[model samples]
Target: MTLRHTRPEARPAWRKSSYSHNDGDCVETAPVRASVAIRDSKDLSVGTLAVPHDAWTYMVDALKG
Candidate 1:
């Protein structure tokens, strides 16, 4: 996959994680280019963390560790 460093002008389609509860502190993710866009569910207007597929996999693995 080709990776391009670009930011979306409009807001991304943010979705709350299934593990999120009504209490808040939710995480959201969206597809942006060849990377996964991650942002706080409460702050959609702010910037998102652009993670490449490989890095995203590593992140998930680390989180599971």
Candidate 2:
């Protein structure tokens, strides 16, 4: 499966991680079809990291372990 990379926009509503603290070091995510859009909550204009749904699930599972 080919993963397409697209520029992140402000149209999608991004939500910050629940584990994030008030220190300003938080990650935000936006659901985009079968993919997920991630970016730093502090500076959204910088860019975003897009990952496939399965890949994102694997990452979260690994992080939990």
Candidate 3:
């Protein structure tokens, strides 16, 4: 995947979900080129889950509905 080729410094900055309550149970997200990455906010080593941009949008829209 293209994400693997992304340099650490070149990766987009991750931001925690707005719904997060500043607790340990938060998730962070970042745009990775055409995809969006989600990861545990409490542990950087937990790994990331990347989803297609459209899929991410769909999920967000569904939740908002």
Candidate 4:
């Protein structure tokens, strides 16, 4: 679903994907404890997608396939 930071000002340092397009349609991610936080680069105020560490690895591997 959606994940949100309690304090909007205290956001983690999110990094945009290298494959992101020049347009605003990009995704950003930040590493949290045992999980990864994903969000839209164009709208950080919306919310985040929290993926577990193992799940993230699996998803990446699958995408590379």
Candidate 5:
């Protein structure tokens, strides 16, 4: 199952994805609690999708392999 939530008033250090482009297709991520927060780089007010650290790590590793 996945968790869904919104960004808090005090935001963390969000970083855009390396695969992002100037055409507005990009994602920003930040580490929060035991999960990683993800949001659209073009719009901060949209909300965030936070996923577990293990899920994030596994996805990243799979992408690299």
Candidate 6:
């Protein structure tokens, strides 16, 4: 499936990973429209990834493994 590129301004909220460290390691997420928005905690303005709720859950579960 092809993912659409979303503009940063289009995102309503942004969240950071609780497990993130200040040493340039971590990710953040927030609800954006019907999906979730993610960005690097270290550089939020630069790297953003938008994912659907179902895919987000699968990604999180995979990360836990």
Instruction: Name the top lDDT candidate.
Output: 4
Q: What lDDT does candidate 2 reach at residue 25? A: 92
lDDT of 2 by residue, 1-65 (tens): 22245666635677889999999899988787778889887875778888999999999999999
Q: How well is each residue in 1-65 modelled by candidate 6, as lDDT tens digits?
A: 22244786754565657777778688767786777777767665585677899999998899999
RMSD of 3: 2.6
Q: What ranges in model 6 sit over 4 Å off?
A: 1-11
| Candidate ranking (lDDT, best to worst) | 4, 3, 2, 5, 1, 6
Candidate 2 clashing pairs, residues 3+ apart or interchain: none
Please give the range of 10 consecutive residues that has the lowest summed lDDT in model 1.
Answer: 1-10
Model 6: colliding residue pairs = 15-29
Q: Count clashes in each candidate, considering only residues at least 3 apart in sequence or on different chains.
A: 0, 0, 0, 0, 0, 1
Q: Which 10 successive residues of model 4 have the least lDDT summed?
A: 1-10
* Global lDDT of each candidate: 0.73, 0.80, 0.81, 0.84, 0.80, 0.71
User: What TM-score does candidate 3 get on C-alpha atoms?
Assistant: 0.78
lDDT of 3 by residue, 1-65 (tens): 22354567886688987788856779988898888988887876767889999999999999999
Query: How many angstroms is residue 2 displaced in model 5 relative to the true structure, after the best TM-score fit?
Result: 13
TM-score of each model, in listed order = 0.64, 0.74, 0.78, 0.76, 0.72, 0.62
Q: Give one digit per residue, the lDDT tens place, for model 5 in 1-65.
A: 23344666555777888889989889988887888988886775777788999999999999999
Tens digits of lDDT, candidate 4, 1-65 = 46556987766778889999999789988888779989998886787888999999999999999
**Pairs with backbone N, CA or C atoms under 3 Å apart (clashes), candidate 3:** none
Clashing pairs in 5: none
Q: Candidate 2: where are CA atoms >4 Å away?
A: 1-10
Better of 3 and 4 by lDDT: 4
For candidate 6, the 10 contiguous residues with the lowest summed lDDT are: 1-10
State model 5's lDDT: 0.80
Candidate 5 weakest lDDT stretch, 10 residues: 1-10
How many angstroms is residue 36 displaced in model 2 relative to the true structure, after the best TM-score fit?
Answer: 0.5
Worst 10 residues of 2 by lDDT: 1-10
